[model samples]
Target: MAGGVAAAVLGAIGGAGAYAYAGEVPRGTSVLGVDIGGKNRSDAIAALHAGLAKQAGKLGNPVAVRLGDRAAEVTPADIDLGVDVEATVTVAIEASPNPIGRLLGSRTVEPVVTLDEGKLHDLLGTALGKDARAMKQPSITFSGTTPKPNYPQPGRGLDAARSADAVRSGWLGGGPVDVPIVEIHPATTKEDVDKLVAEFARPAVSAPVTVTTERGDVTVAPAAIAKSLRLVADKAGRIEPALDAKKLRAALSTPLGAVEVQPKDARVAIVSGKPRVTEGTEGRQVDVTALATDLLAVLPKSDERTVTGKLVAAKPATTAADVAKLGIKERVSTFTTKFTGGLGAPRSQNIVQIAKDVDGTLVKPGAVFSLNGHTGERGYRQGYRDAPVILDGKLVPGVGGGTSQFTTTLFNAAYYAGLEDVHHKPHSYYFDRYPAVIESTIFWPDLDMKFRNNTEYGVVIDTSWTDNSITVSMYSTKVWDSVSTEYSPRRNITSPKVIKLPKGPTCIATNGIPGFTQDAFRVFKKDGKVVEREKFTWTYSAEPRFTCG
Candidate 1:
């Protein structure tokens, strides 16, 4: 009975012990759980600290966590827990039956863990926030002293602060920091301002002053004086001062003497000595002499007081009376008879008188006198010859036929005198009596022979007639050189032809006369050498004859 009671007691004790051991397990603690195994608050805190420490080490810096009003700092040193927390099952035995064969039950209890999460977060936040604060309010200092003559002193202080802010912002974990910039005024010391003034200022330049004697003026530039003084000016100052009267006087005064200033429009007049006369023709001579005196009074003279004059006379006029007295007498006397069987015999004195009157009118040198001007219109009542004269290619009696002889003679005289023949003509056909290329025939105004006095001296023509002959002579100033004419041989001649005509009278007419051409040349010679040779071609047309019945 007692053994049964003892067994019951032992079984009840064993059941109670089992129930107590099962109740000892942690409510929220687990081997692999939410917080990674911690039974108490302290252990959990310790584990969190260890985890954060490891994380801080891997991050290489403090970890910062912002709280409501403050930041928490976590660092490797604050959170590093070197202790290991491990659970083990230990059984406390009161008694054992066999030392080697004892069966014992065990119970597990978690080991104590320690963490410093608050300290770790506080340290990290402090360190990192301090760095951020330092970056926000950066400090800058200048070691060098301020320069003298600080024209822009305030700018230097601001520039130094800006440089420091730039460096601070460039660092990692650093941001734009608000820095208080203060200006430090260095002690002012005097420096030779001349060099600085010279550096910044402009030097003066001077313009040259000109004094002109001809224009009678003097000019001075204030800039020139400023240049001489080596003056310099600032941006707002004048480059140079204006020229005062005193300065002007000082500049002008010299050993040479002050420059004279004349009126702006000053002028001077100068006069010369008596006039001079020059050689000229009568009227021209008088006018030239007058001009000389007038010009002399107006011209400027340097020295002499005397002036000279000259006079020249024009050529004299030669009249018929003068030519008649030239002592040239007619050596040959000749007569040309114009007789027709039917025409009544006119008094021969009528033609003779016409020639005589014409001879009274003398032609002077270089004179071109027209026959019409000297001879009135020819009429029978006027004592002109009614004798047969060629009119419009028919036989008509008029005052002139033989008058042409007078012109021919005068032409020859002019030619011999070495005058320039201006106009002349030849007969329609060749005439046997006249020299080839030397003959000159005339018919009043139609065929006129005119010559110019090419020689510098004057000439006179003399004419006279007798009952049987007429003669003409030319008198001129003695020529230093002799003149002569030469003729070229005839050329381009055509044979003449004979023809019979049926007019009232039976007379044989030549159909064609031989054509012959020649050139006449006048050779002007001085001192036996030919100076000039003038040529004139005389073309002869074929002469035709008519046989009349």
Candidate 2:
């Protein structure tokens, strides 16, 4: 009975095979929603193309793409986005190549779409606007003059491969699909910045800078300038070196300032109608500005760091005997300056330091005395703190911030005293505490506030200060009968730019102020006649402050 049943099944299969061999297509065979059943090969091919004519006209009916309301339409034809009809037809045709398989089983062919991936890739690339930054993989770049890694910035774009796969999958699975075009994004990270900082920047501050001279070598430890060395972004938004000029100048202050000597000029005075002659002396001074320039050359070295520079001489053109015959008498000029004190602690410390250095300083006949030479270095160990210092025309925290206030005091005192002008630099910005157009700024071992004693007699410096007030008094016998001052209103006044930063852990806030330029003059009178006159100009910088979260 079992054998008979098997024979009946075999006969049924054979009959089905015979029927399939004689037939073209059974009844229902469709592809891409096009029915090709019971049709010949040529008819099926024609039907395939006709059914997909609408899909080929994808430009007219584009697939709607949306990324969080950022809508974009993509033409499938433009991207060569279409089904592989021939391959799909081959798959359909091959499904029932044998008679038994054709009659006994039914098969459905999902078209295998073929597209010009390069063109698709290009289409995806153009999907974004020029303003839309493409996602970038993390990479190292030596785009700068120096050899170092640049930190990466975040960006966004459509994911090419995954998006293509999704398009094909949707078409094959369901006809109605509003593709949720997934967005690919670059890492929103500063990890690269952190990495470079760890790998290079932090290690750079590990060793002290060895500045070698023929006489000896001086070391500026990392601790001194490390805080000043910042990983600042360049114009291209790459991390670069930000060596604080103020900090570097302050750090090199002592060693270099020690090498300088204030020149002595011959002193001559009239006493009992006899001219007394004081000897002239030679002197040496360090070229600290040049040293600052050379710092970049030697700082990033494994070994051998030495720099040599020219020293400026304070040479007296005339001897004391030569000037003695001129017959100049006492009390030429004198002036006083007052300051509002009750200062901040950092400023107070700097003021006290400067006042101590300036007091008891003597300016002799035909001689020059520099405030910097007298004060030497303003070092942290020497009572200076990381207060706000002016740098690159901006006031920021540095080692000797408030010292400039003293510069104003001494400079104005010398100016009103009818002293000879030498060299003085004014602040970049105006401060209410300082007298406008009549102020000074100093960077030790480089810039200085100097005045020459053109008078025959010597002038003495006296200083007194409280928390709320301070005074600078220059005492000398009157060479000019009186000294008076004139001034011009600020010209070329400009306002500062305000910068805003997003609210974050790195947010910082600073208030900005305006800038201007002005001039002041001192007139000296002897017997009510003008004997000498001097002029001083100040160019204040516009300080741009930051506004933050």
Candidate 3:
């Protein structure tokens, strides 16, 4: 009998919970001064819409905002500032959940309002633009041959943060809101500008300055000084004057060119099938940094406008002693790729141009060399002619078309040299001109081939080409006794699709080639033992058959 009584009590509690969840909203609930108590979800939403509509009619009009003495009007709809009716109703329903609490509780919810602070800030800036002025700091810059001075000025602007809060709280109340306007002061004042101009700028451009170095003396004209001079205001409002080192160096180079001796870097060349090192020479040049400092010290002087700059010894980037220690004594690896075009052909010209740039490049030990980084952009500006290049599986006339052949040659040379392959991407489609899966394609700034000389010895890249073939050779201490490649049989073969198009300059008709996936392994041997083995794989897309109508 006790178990039966407990079961009846539990059933009554569950019924009460379900009725409360699905029943009308909690009693005596209100939002934005609108009574929505004891109503269903739909009825509550309808009541909120009807009641808020009347309130919006009064408050939705253009609101007047005052910033300092300036006044502007903004409509609530223009800034997306208004109350959300459905959201307000949702808050009311979720306020009281317990059945007993819903029966006895009375709650008031803040209305759900929407306001885009960013939009309101921008509106305030534009509306009160006359009253908003940015503080101008003192500065001096050149205007043609004369130095121009800009004086500092105090300003005033609307404080967007406090003003946004005011609009949020009072805009809905349907009254004119007063936005706070704050005064802005420049870090520097007009007095600083006047002092800088009088003591530095005026005298700096009055006469030519003479820089005496160990090599000789060079006179910089007054006009040159005006162009290279820079006067800027610091955070503490102090005016600072400085000479642009790069600009001054360029301006003084020609006049001092004869007296200055440029440094020469050591070079490596192949002589009698062996690497030969040429000694570098040290040269003397003007010390621009010290000259600038010295010039600043005497620039304001009326009579002593000459400054003596200490001549510092300029060393070559690579000295002969440095190159002699690099252990580049013999040819370590060499690779060649064949091309069919004649010397006058655009493709052949591009291939030769790239080979010229790649020739005589020295890769330091543990340094990664990138083809794109070294050669830069290969466009018409770089003298690369337009030739047939593969694009979207079709051959189109493009610049730097034949440079990829050179890239393939260089990749094979670096591969056999026992260097670490940092990054290399193969062509999307297979071409019979290049070795199946072992070749790489290159584009300006994007696709590239890179290799790192991981050995302790440096490697020198030497390139040579004939009308029909290009060869790349690397000279270094041979770490790998022998390097060879093993190939895996092609798989996942797919036939090309036949694509017909109208005959146009953009289309190049071709017989399609089959695509397949293949892998190549590079084995490095030292003392007749396998030291390292690297695996490379690529999947070639089937070249579509193009038939021009």
Candidate 4:
């Protein structure tokens, strides 16, 4: 027919240029619709890698596209479509029923991607920096410590900014920090043990050491230890070795001694068992070692001793050759005269004619006698001073008013010789011709009379007088054998008043005579039994009869 119809139009233009060099997609091209028409480029790149691996499995990753200015990693093996690349494209569209009218004529395509944008920004910065490091959050620190500060533990801490930055970064650990140390710990309380025992106690000061000793002698009384430490004496507190001068020279040579006075020598004729009278005088032999060297030159010498002496003995003297050496025998008396009743007459010489003129002798055995050596002062020219005188009661001009009745008849012959009355006085009133207890009296220096030969046997007194008879006789060694008297016939009698005279011769009657009362007794014997019996009483008043003009 016209050359067979022009070879059928050149094989149909060589099959449409082999479907555009094999990257085909024309028969009802609906790629994801299961219709890749002539499907060349390796089956249209295997259907565009199964349609982008189903859109990259629903876009789970790898997919950036925009080619031209570069940006392409379309994974799924880079959508080869069998590699005809060159900005690949193939199309022959159909299927328009609104699938976007079949993808709008479909064929506008390119995909030969290969990209590494710095490894995709290092895999998206290492997968978004590993998901921003797994969304992090953790932090919290701080450290400081010091500990153990002994004693009262004075290392304070309350976390002072973490112990001052742990003492400037010197580190310690365990976070919640707080440290500071130094330890000791002991003093509990009582003011912290009195400030730790006042920093270790000890204060009783004042010491001057020096205490030498092998044991013994220690006198530390420095003012009693300075008044027991209250201090003073220059704050005293230090004595030693100053006062034992050999124990103060043995305590001043031992003191404490005195009290002495011994004397002995009393032999009044063996206490008067007597009969004495020995005459032997002659004694004058003193030289007693030159009087003990002149009394040791007036005593005192032991280094001129301060006080302490000895030399006793001095008491002895009673001579008349010590009473004729005690052998006994001496008597002499015989001078008599009589004439009672005349001599200025006053009722014919009364007072019993002056108790018959003085007569004396009687004192023996260990005797020491003297009454001016036995009476002998009767002067008035030896005529008895103005004779009859009793003055204040009548008769005047007195001289010794009847010489105390011649000492009351020689004290009744020395109390009938048994004497020992060493001193006597009686007559402040009552006076019955004297004899009231063997009366005796005188007043020359205010009355006096004494006796003492207390019979150990020795007495002799024979004296006689006459102006009207007076006699006194006594001789002993007969120590009483018989002597008698007994009288008790007077009772409570008082009368004789009249004493009113401020200056007038008022009721002047100076005791002349009136009241009277009596009682008397005396009996002494030895070999005849009845050894002693003595008693006497005489009370008389009523003698007030005065008249003075």
Candidate that scores best on TM-score: 3
Model 4 residue 26 distance off true place after TM-score fit, in angstroms: 99
User: Relative to the true structure, how large is the alpha-carbon lDDT of every model?
Assistant: 0.42, 0.64, 0.84, 0.39
List the candidates ranked by TM-score, beginning with the highest: 3, 2, 1, 4
Candidate 1 lDDT by residue in tens digits, 1-549: 999999999998787555433322222233212233213445544554565456444434543433223444433345552223332101111121231122132222232323354443344334344233211111111122111222312111222334233222321233322333334332221132333333321121112233333323344333423322312222222222222334334544441133332112111111131111122222212123332343233222222322322223333243334444433232111223232332234434444545555553434445665545566654565565644444443333466555555556666666666677888886656656455676666555566666776654434444555554455555545453766779889998966555445664323334455678999898877788998888888888666554455
Query: TM-score of model 3 relative to the true fold?
Result: 0.56
lDDT of 3: 0.84
Those runs of model 3 whose alpha carbons end farther than 4 Å from true positions after fitting are: 1-239, 243-262, 282-286, 291-314, 501-504
RMSD of each: 48.7, 22.5, 20.4, 58.9
Which of the numbered candidates is closest to the native, going by highest lDDT?
3
Give the Å shift of residue 243 in candidate 4: 99
> Worst 10-residue stretch by lDDT in candidate 3?
16-25
Write the number of the candidate with greater TM-score, choosing between 1 and 2.
Answer: 2
lDDT of 4 by residue, 1-549 (tens): 988889999987677655443434553454334445446556755666666566654433344432123233333233221223323433232212333333233443333333333333333223222222221111111111111111222221122233233322321121221223222222232353333223211111122111122222123222222222211111111111112233322322212111222232222221132334332233322222332233222222212212122223434343445434433342211112233554444322433333333222335575744343455454455344534433343334455555555555656566555465566655545555555445655644456666676655445555544446455555454456555567676666566665443434223335445565666667787776886777656555455544343
Which is superior by TM-score, 2 or 3? 3
Model 4: ten consecutive residues of lowest lDDT: 139-148
